[model samples]
Target: MAYSERLAERIRKALTHLPIKEKKMFGSLAFMVNGKMCLTAGPERMMCRIDPDLHEREVKRHGCNTVIMGGREYKGYIHIQEENLKSEKDFDHWVRLALEFNEKLTSS
Candidate 1:
């Protein structure tokens, strides 16, 4: 399935002030900040790269689900249904979480 171009555009707008790049990964259009993947606008949902420590609480949020890939669960990545992104505020909230986490990452 193809990723959502519209959603990708919105994400682009939100991250415009940062040094970010767009790439195709996980069958989705991912937004990378400082060479790290911060978020992705997938075919049917938005993938948020948050703090792994918050996974248990975040997964309980509306339209959020555990991101399982290759039959394995990715602790820090969670999927947000399209329905949850109808509002720009909601969309930005997820983006903020992702950016916040990305900021905390140590430079390699």
Candidate 2:
């Protein structure tokens, strides 16, 4: 399944307040804010960068599972289900978390 263009557009609009840059990466679209990768949308999946310090908290809060690719679990990233993204509020929350993590890494 391919990523929905509508979903991507909605995400981009919601993130207008942030200074973010979009690029093609890993055959998908990546949103980088402040030079750190924040969010990604690929065929059938949407993921967000997780802050190492708050990984556990975020997982628990959002029920997000680690992103598994190529037979390994990629830490510091979570795959968000499409169903959860249907609501604007839900999508914003995920984007906000990604932005927060990106900010922390770039500032530190």
Candidate 3:
């Protein structure tokens, strides 16, 4: 298994309690909750989910780049750096965002 696979597995284990599913996408794995992408990992170094309404702000705040695929920038999704995942608190922050988005999306 590649590093990404290991990383994905770790993330999967961490999020097992959440109502989410993992799928292969962009040569990596994407975590979806309620049919919307909440997290992604692969060639990209990080994983994060952004609010579509505040994507730009979030991106700038994190100093991260937008995920662009097939000539389109995937709004509301930000790539997280592996270095940022060193701490459980940091990882949990992103997870919280994903969960919040999932809950908001499902409630509507």
Candidate 4:
């Protein structure tokens, strides 16, 4: 599968109250809120577009990694392994963080 349907379902449930739009991008299923990128579910993993200020601290978390493309690190973006999302708390953390950042973007 290009992306994790299971993970996508989980994300869908989490954001059920919000108006979310899904699209296939970067070989993943991207969740967009307020017309901005929020999260993406890929093969056995997910990516979050969070606040750049939290990048350093968040990358230190278990199974969390800064997103890198072509050897360049993308701050405020991270890939989270599915293993770390086994618990609802962990999963909610990422979803909340991504939404918070997305909200900030829309507000500004």
The number of the candidate with the highest TM-score is: 4
Query: Worst ten-residue run, lDDT, model 2?
Result: 54-63
Leading candidate by lDDT:
4
The stretch of ten residues in a row with the least summed lDDT in candidate 4 is 1-10
lDDT of 2 by residue, 11-105 (tens): 68878988888888776788888877888886656788977776766666544688778989777788877677777788888888787788778
Report lDDT per candidate. Answer: 0.90, 0.77, 0.73, 0.94
Error of 1 at 107 (Å): 6.0
Q: Which candidate do you rate higher for TM-score, 2 or 3?
A: 2
Model 3: per-residue Cα lDDT over 35-57, one tens digit each? 88777777636567767787777
Model 4 per-residue lDDT tens digits across residues 1-108: 689999999999998999999999878999999999899999999999999999999999999999999999999999999999999999999999999999899997
Models ranked on TM-score: 4, 1, 2, 3
Per-residue lDDT of model 1, residues 36-73, tens digit only:
88999999799999999988998998999999988999
What overall lDDT, based on C-alpha atoms, would model 3 receive against the true structure? 0.73
| Candidate 2 off by > 4 Å | 60-63
| TM-scores vs. true structure, each candidate | 0.93, 0.81, 0.79, 0.96
